[model samples]
Target chain A: MLPFVFEWQWDIGHGVFMGLFYLALTIVSLGVVAALAMTFYDLYSGKEVHEEGHGHEDPWADYSYAHDKADRGEYA
Target chain B: MDDSKFWPKGTTRCKPVHFGLWMLFCLALAGWALVSAFLCLYKGLNQTNMNDYFAFGVWIVVDLAIIALGAGAFFTGFMNYVLRREELKNIINAAVIIGFICYSGAIMMLGIDIGQPIRGWFGFWHANVHSMLTEVMFCITTYLIVLIVEFVPLILENRQINKVPDLHFFAHNLHTIMIVFAATGTFLSFFHQGSLGGMYGVLYARPFAARGGVLIWPWTFFLFILSAIAAGPSFTTSIVMITEIVTGKKLTTHKVKMLMAKVSGSLLLFYLVLKIADTLYWAFVQTPAMGLSPSVYYQAPYGTWLLIAELGIGGVLPCILLLSPQVRESYWILLLAMLLNCFGVTMNRFVMTIQSLAVPVLPFEKFYAYLPTWQEWGISAGVIAYGFIIFSLAYRYLPVFPQETKLNPTTD
Candidate 1:
């Protein structure tokens, strides 16, 4: 996606495509970095762990606990 | 075993034995792929029925089909993130997961489809700006990255996974500013979808596929984009319905399904009009310019009936069925219409790839037909197997459908 890549060209097609592609990548990366920075700062400052609530089931609990379909439906 | 922990907390699933059998079936298909890979790598593509004339073959067809079906991810992300359609939030994760499977599978298949898998990088290193394949390679790879970025947040959002403070925060931030990624994906997808068709259209040597149009892109270029998007949502809906039937659970509300159908039908209507115009122009002007009658294009093995089936049975009928409110509302009719729509696009890609090669351009050239050998079938099966394995994993792990909890509540 970089302009310096061997396939990179000065044409409008490559310029526009690669330009927007990099832009998106930058935004996504920035979002991640910003999140990391904030979390680290909070942790270092000993800000009370922002635990929302105990009842809030971890979103991925459903994933790690089950491999087959039958086991997944036990609670249902 | 706590079944609820695995099946989205509340959704019903088939019995363990049945699920095991299904997994076994998938594994068997995957084994077929292993054989296909061995034959293709050792014996070469000659193992395929494809000859010099039909170099593209079924691999290209499968590639195009998956890419077209995968458009739902970009289109749905566009709607949910850019257009601010909140209801679609329910199914956006599923679309992303499916998109991931389709793209990764297509890319993997392409790696093998080329004569030299290791040298596939030459397409980029020895750049051909004029080549439509170059454009496809660029856009598809870029879009795959975009899809992965889009999927990351969902992966992080998994119940047990997001417990990590860093991942949780990252996912939340990513979701907050997802519009940038979504818009970029839409841009990349649009071009690749068009370029795939552009690849065929620019083949002036192949009159059956060539066309005149605005700068750079031919009419087929635009038509391919329209057809992919028009059929994409329907394909996604069909998949969701299949999952529901298999699991005995509803993952999306009726309204969401109806909205998806309406969007697909309207786009299909627009596409049909343009496609028909393009066909007529090709028949009346383009074909004759190359000193061939329209009827000459379709003979014997590939007869007029193929066109009738493509445009009439596959095209108009599905469009009409989907567009009408009565038919769209009826689950059976809507499902059947979507199936027909998927069939129509596959047929279109098949014709564009195979039939284009089948039609002889030179008077001395004889018409040729091809059938995929077991080896070729194995590779194709491999791609399908890959898609199934990836998608099944995503569904099993990720909270792909937000509406799941509401639709089929886990009664603790």
Candidate 2:
């Protein structure tokens, strides 16, 4: 997916698509790096695990449970 | 007895032996597919029903069908992550796994579909930006990478596996910022899904497939994208329902399924309107410009009835069933509607890929029909077998359904 790949081009389609693609990749990588660094620092410092069971709440979590509610007639 | 003795711990499951037997049956199917794939490769595509006139054949149809069906992964990911549709979360993981299987399988089939598998890389190396097929190849491969990344955390979250400190941390961290990956996947999927239709549209020699459009993309490109996103959620619904039947567990709430149906229905309505308009334009403007009547394109066996099947039974019926709140809200009705929606999308892909090729575009050419040889079926069946095996494994190992333990708590 890199621009340097032989298939890569500098046309409008490539420019727009590859631009968005790379930006997303960069964000994800940065997030991973930040989390790893934080976890490593905590482990070495002998800090207790965060007491809050609040994991990174998934964006779709609540939506996911709605299926069961609908089945149970709770929504109606 | 311990809570763990309840089989899945959270819910009941079939006996291990029973599960193993089912796996064994799937393996047999896979074995048949392997043999078929070998025969097709060894004897060449000549072994299949494909001829010079219908070179694209059943393999392409199956490829396109699975790709379209697999669109659930990208679309659900998009809605859940980008659009902030929280209800989709329950199904997105399953969608991602299915997408991974479909894409990897399609890529494998392409390796076989090409005359020289090794030289297939030449398409990328030579870089034909003008060719829609090139765009499709690039986008699909890149998106497959994205799908794998999206699925990794899910695998890492497997009950026993998540205990490992490194994997656990990795999964947690990866998930914490999953929005980025989901965005990337959406972008990639949008292009590949369109480019697939663009591939057919660029066949200027085939008027039925060709159309006037902006830049290099034809109308089919946009139409294909609409149809995929429109029908994707329905496919996911169908799959989840099937899973429930097999597992005998209510893995999701009815509200979530209804939300999905409502979305799918609305999208399908939009898609249907555009599709009809496109068809009318093609019939009156495009086809006539090419010096052919609409009927001339469908000279029998693959005639207007095929159109009826796609547009009428598959398209109209499903849209009606899904759009009617009374119908879609009904459990059985919604299931039937979703089933029809899936069928409609598959038919759309089939028409675009196989039937388009089957119709001869040249003035001197005659219409042709093709059937997949046993070997061709083998490769396609192999894809199904692969999907079933992988999904079953993921379900068995991974805590894919976060609500499973909550909804079906053990009472020892």
Candidate 3:
């Protein structure tokens, strides 16, 4: 997607397609960079270290554990 | 139980031994593909059934099929993130993973199919600006990157992986700006999906597939987009359904599946109407103007019955089945309709790639039959294996279905 690529055309078709291709690549690259920047910044700043809401805080809280108990002949 | 730590929070997974056995089976198929890929790269294209007349074989067919089916990622993203549909968020993660697998695997197959992996970059560095294939190469690769970016957060959300503070935060950050990547994916995918059709449509000399165009794009271009948009969600829903069936869990509610069905049915109706119109124009006006009858393209294996199956049975039936409230509410019937819709789109692509090439463009060039070699079959099997293995891992590790926890709640 570089300009130095020799097969590059100076026409509308090439301009439009190549333009869009580079644009997408740029957005993807920037998104990754932004994520890294924010992540590290969060680490440096000591932001609240919270776990994901789904099964993060207490794995044993899962309903499947109840199934395990029932399977073992213990009534729910 | 050994792998419970890896499972998404609140979720229960299959026994490690069972999961390991499934992985082993996938590995064997993958091994066949690797051997096929090695032979194709080392020996040459001759290892396959491709000939001069039948230049595009099962590889292209498989590639086109997966890429079209993969359109669910962008379309779903467009709906959830762009159109602001909250309910779709429940299923969008799975859609993204499927899209990533389909696109990336198709890229790998293309690398093998082109005979030389190293030279595949020439499509980018030395692009033919006017060629539809060139457009497809550029858009598909870029969209693959977007899919990866969209998928990164889900990876970081793995139960153990999310324990890392920085990685967790990074995943959170990515989610915040996901709409940008989703929009980019939608843009890139729209072109590649259409260009794939334009690749067949631009065969000005090939009367069966060629059509009049506006500026540079052809009728098949728009039709391909509609067909893809129609089939993509249905394919995703079918996969999710299969996953639910196998896992014996309600990954997402019937509401979400029904919503997807309604969307698919509407698009399928639009596609069928346009496709029927396109076929009529091609059969009566376009072919006659080129001094040929529709009979020229219909031979033994590639005959009118294929058209009947593609449109009447696969296309029309599914559209009706999905649209009816009664049929769609029944889980099995709805899933069957979605499956048929996907089959219809696959048939369309197969006809475009295989049947289009089957018809002789020149008077002296006779019609020829082509079947994929065992190596070609092996390569295709590899794509399937790759998709299965990756999705299996993702479903095991990541929080793919948000609704799973609520639907199948465990007693505390």
Candidates, DockQ: 0.14, 0.27, 0.26
Cα lDDT over the full model 3: 0.87
The total of clashing pairs for model 3 equals 1
Worst 10 residues of 3 chain B by lDDT: B403-412
Using DockQ, give the best candidate's number: 2
Clashing pairs in 3: A63-B410
Q: What are the per-residue Cα lDDT tens digits for candidate 1 across B1-412?
A: 4443544334455566766677788889989988887778878888888887888898899999989989999998899789988767766777887888889889988887886789887766665665787778877887888788878877776556666776666666566667877888898899899999988888999988999989888988999999999988888888888887777776676567777888888988999999999999999988888888987778778888888887787789999998998886677788889888888888899889988999888879987777788877887888887777777766765677765665566666
Question: Per-candidate TM vs. native?
Answer: 0.89, 0.89, 0.94
Q: Please estimate how well model 1 matches the true structure, expressed as its whole-model Cα lDDT.
A: 0.78
Q: Write the per-residue lDDT of candidate 3 for residues B210-237, one digit (tens) a residue.
A: 8887888998899999999999999999
How much does each candidate deviate from the true structure in C-alpha RMSD?
5.6, 3.7, 4.3
Compose the digit string of candidate 2's lDDT tens values, residues B1-412: 1322322334566667777898998899899888877777777777777777777876788888888888899999999888988767777887888889889988888877885687887865665655677767767887887788788888866555655666666677677777877887888788889988888777888877888889767888998998888888898888887887788777765667788888898999999999999999999988988788888768667888888888888889999999897886577788999888888888888888777887777668788777777788888888889888998877776666655555554575
Best TM-score among the predictions, by candidate number = 3
For candidate 1 chain A, the 10 contiguous residues with the lowest summed lDDT are: A60-69
lDDT, residue B170, candidate 3? 84
Name the candidate that leads on lDDT. Answer: 3
TM-score, candidate 1, is 0.89
TM-score of chain B of 3: 0.99
